[model samples]
Target: MRSDLCSLLGIEKPIFSAPMGGAAGPDLVASVCNAGAYGVIPLWGKPVDQVAAGIDQIRALTDRRFAVNLNLSFAYEDALEACIQAGVHGVSLFWGMEPSAIARAKAGGLVVMSSVGSVAEGQAAEAAGADIIIAQGWEAGGHVWGQVSTMALVPAMVDAVGVPVVAAGGIADGRGMAAAFMLGASGVWIGTRFLASREATIHPDYLTHVLGASEAQTEWYHDLYDVAWPNAPHRALSNSTARAWRDAGAAPPGQRPNEHEIIGTRPGGDPVVRYQSYTPLPGTTGDVEAMSLWAGQGVALVREVQGAAEIVDEIFDEAMTCLAGGPGKPGPN
Candidate 1:
């Protein structure tokens, strides 16, 4: 059954994949959308032409609806303009709230989805004209924005905002989606689970680690991987770099262990140093283990890699079953 959020965003399922940087490429995004769920592509901080091309690529892949996310933490005017010009169905603004940016996207006839970490931020985004609010909790993978857990934040955000609330962070399976619905969320915003999708551009080693990790394997950091995106809190799986930092008593940035060591190189020959906030995509070479391996607490639920469409279908079907029976009730055996 289509939720109000599904209708609002012109999709059949109230499931929106998190725009996990390079991993949320056109193929995966298209696959998710084609499965009747919404997908999001990350074009944050990308050049205007590249942003336009990404949207075009998605258009070529599927006629289904999707959104392009822009990190408000960086300079995004040009990229936002490209999204508006491309006539994309929606735009996700994260990291911080920008009313003018939201206004511009709305003015361009684009539905605006903004991610927030707190009740105050949710209210602010709504007041700024955000069409939907993605309440990102602390357990989310990648660059996280808030300190509250999903259980605590979703209901509060729902209570605080008039717009539809999408509960993000630590939600990977149908149970979490059902829980979100019980908490008054219009939908669920999932990221870490998608990392195991066959279409994700993740390194083999990174995928392996994610598959083997448990709910307790993830660690929340206050800017540990801060080479590029400093001062942002994030969640990542434990690795040698993390062990070193813990061994060193969680030293500060400038004094952290392996402060400036080159650990890997991007596909384009850009150097990736230790403690850098970079996901290990395919073609990246060097000490991949030392690079940032982002994963949410929900990684435990993601046992194997599947096609993006399969994942969308599985979660959506399971969620419909669980939601039908009510929370804590098992679906038909």
Candidate 2:
């Protein structure tokens, strides 16, 4: 099923793999694009040369459509320049909104997508010339924008914006994909569900924690702390770090535990920090318990690690069956 988005990007399916920073690799992105879906590489914190190298790697693997994700809150100009140099097919912006940035991307003949958390933001994005708007609800993992659920946010975005809407957050299976389409989204951008796949470069320990987690396992630390993502909810597996923060009354400003110290590795490879986002915890080896696990509520739906191509094919096949008024069976090889 092709929507305006699919045709614009020259893809057969509207499903787009999120540019999961740190975790998403060239092989993973290429695998998705080769399967007739759009894959995105996160360009956060990477230098221009490194970003170009990653783009070159993906280009070498597949000649299909793909994109680069630019977190506007970061150094976006560098990311945009690298994407342009690498000849990316499209670009997606997150964190903050930038109309001029979108315009520049469009002027370069690249499709542009932006993530929005509210109706006003969605309308503004459309008015600013964003080709597509992604309604990212609070249930989404990683850094979040606001506190709206996808069910309520998607329809509102569709109504507010003339551009096509893509529903994100809490969507994992074919049923959720159909529900998003029913809710007026032309496409779906998934993250946590795909993060559990084998192609993802996250630590195996982190993946295991995701598999064993429940919806209630995630909580918001912003309410009790003065973090950068304050008031913005983030879904992650509950761990000692979280419990300690909660028990310590969220810690005073200077008292707040240092993320890099607690989560980062020590000099000379000492095992001081316990977790470091994507990397596995030091000394734990294959043990999954002593790490930080980032995931969405959709973790409940991910039971196994499959190839990226297979995962995309399964989701699309099941979604097509559902749209055809047939039982949406699980994707099989």
Candidate 3:
């Protein structure tokens, strides 16, 4: 049974991949779209030209529709305009809400999806003309917005908004998707599970950590990785940097242990310091483990890496089985 939200987004499956920065590259996004599930490409903080190029890259890979996600915490007016000009299917906004931005996107004929942490935020986004509301819980990877859990936020958002609600954070397998649907989510927004997709561009070490982590291994932080991005609350695997900070009294930014130490370098020769909001990609060199390794509590269920299309099919099948009164496995096949 295809959800109305799926039809609205022009996809067959009601699964929307999270717009994970760096990891959600064109290949992964295209793979998900080709699988009839929605894909979201993270384009926040990039220049207008790069944004256009990124869209073009995805277009070259798949003819199916997908969205470009923008972090409102950063300047995104130009990038949003670029997506509008490129005739993309939709735009997902997160981190903050701006009615003007939503109005402008809607005016440009884009389906606007906004991520919120609470019922009040969902109502505000619906009022601001958001066609879809993504209720992100504290267990979500990367930058988390709200303090509530998915179990508590999904139904509240559905009841609070007139638009469709997409449940995010801590969802991994078919059991999780079925649970989200039971909680009144029209669709599920997944991030950590997709990190294990073969098409994802994350570093091998990062993938290793995701495949091995448990539900209790991830910890929520308030600006722990705040070199380029600050004042953002996020969830990532508890690693050396996190342990060091906690061991040293969980000091605030600038005073944290080894605050100025360079942990690695990006493919483009940019230095990556400890506690910086940087995902380790293939070309990254130097202490990769010490860098920020983002993952949700769903990491416990992501036990192996599989092709994006295969991953989508497995989850969809299992979710359908679960919805049809069968016992769906809690972890990946």
Candidate 4:
């Protein structure tokens, strides 16, 4: 059941974990890679020292290939160079990147993948020499690049690009993956499902919200939380902060209530300021419920926490079953 994309990445599965900054830390990435699924860690806005250091940790954990990503919208050039030097198997470029930059990564012998919000963006990425193109939909959690659903965007990008297309957004289970394969996606990039896994370093409260909520509880719109990373539209679970902002008339950036308020702290005690675009991690306290509960529309399907490998195997079995024209179920194929 492997696709060319999996063969290109040398992974047994066609599932690529989303490079969720802050949430998808090195532990989760390494676990997924070791499990035979592609793992991606977001490197943008992180400390330069941590870029290679995180790769070191993953390398120590698993010898398998994995990827790191850069959100050009808030990237540090030096970090990009550092990743190239570290020799990660792949690098995902996002947020309207220049083709020359993708060329630079390719020159370093790094497999280049770019995320696109539109079919035109997919074409541009392919022209820019992206070896793989991730078609990110509006249903994806955290900061979204463009406004299109997976159902419509995947096939369009597949039609638009010559490279392999990876479908993202709203995909939470084997059913979604099978559907994506039918839509011409060479692979599927899953986020929220990984967020519910045991390897994720997010706050327990956040996990609780993900498990307890339904699909309708998740919402995507513009709000103040983007103050830390402005201009990028994101999708997340409806939490207290979202409710307050929504009730307060959904004010624009500058007019939002409690602007710059210090809401919580990082697990290591770093101050979590208002609108910081911070996803609650372990050891975090103070209004954890109010912090960004970023998740995909697939959050509804996320029922419980399991090891990363188990989640991968479960998804693999069900997706294979669906593709084989059988009823999707857990357990064995």
Candidate 1 local distance difference test against the native: 0.91
lDDT of 2 by residue, 184-237 (tens): 999999988888777888766677777777888866445322233334345567
Q: What tens-digit string does per-residue lDDT give for candidate 3 at 1-333?
A: 688898798899999889999999999999999999999999989999999999999999999999999999899999999999999999999989898889999999999999999998888889989999999998899999989999999998888788899999999988999999999999999999999999999999999999999999999988999888888988999998899899999998979999889988999999999989998999999998899999999899999999999989888999999999888964553
Residues 150-256 of candidate 1: C-alpha lDDT, one tens digit per residue? 99999999988899999999999888898899899999999999999998999999999999999999999998999999999899999999998999999888999
Each prediction's number of clashing residue pairs: 0, 0, 0, 0
**Best of the candidates, lDDT:** 3
lDDT of each: 0.91, 0.77, 0.92, 0.86
CA lDDT for candidate 2: 0.77
Question: In model 3, which regions exceed 4 Å deviation?
Answer: 330-333
Q: Please, what is the TM-score per model?
A: 0.97, 0.89, 0.98, 0.96
**Number of the candidate with higher lDDT, 3 or 4:** 3
Cα RMSD for candidates in order:
1.6, 3.7, 1.8, 2.1
**TM accuracy, model 2:** 0.89
Q: Flag regions of model 4 displaced more than 4 Å.
A: 330-333
What's the lDDT for residue 167 in model 4?
94
Off by over 4 Å in 2: 223-233, 257-291, 329-333
TM-score of candidate 3 against the unseen true structure: 0.98
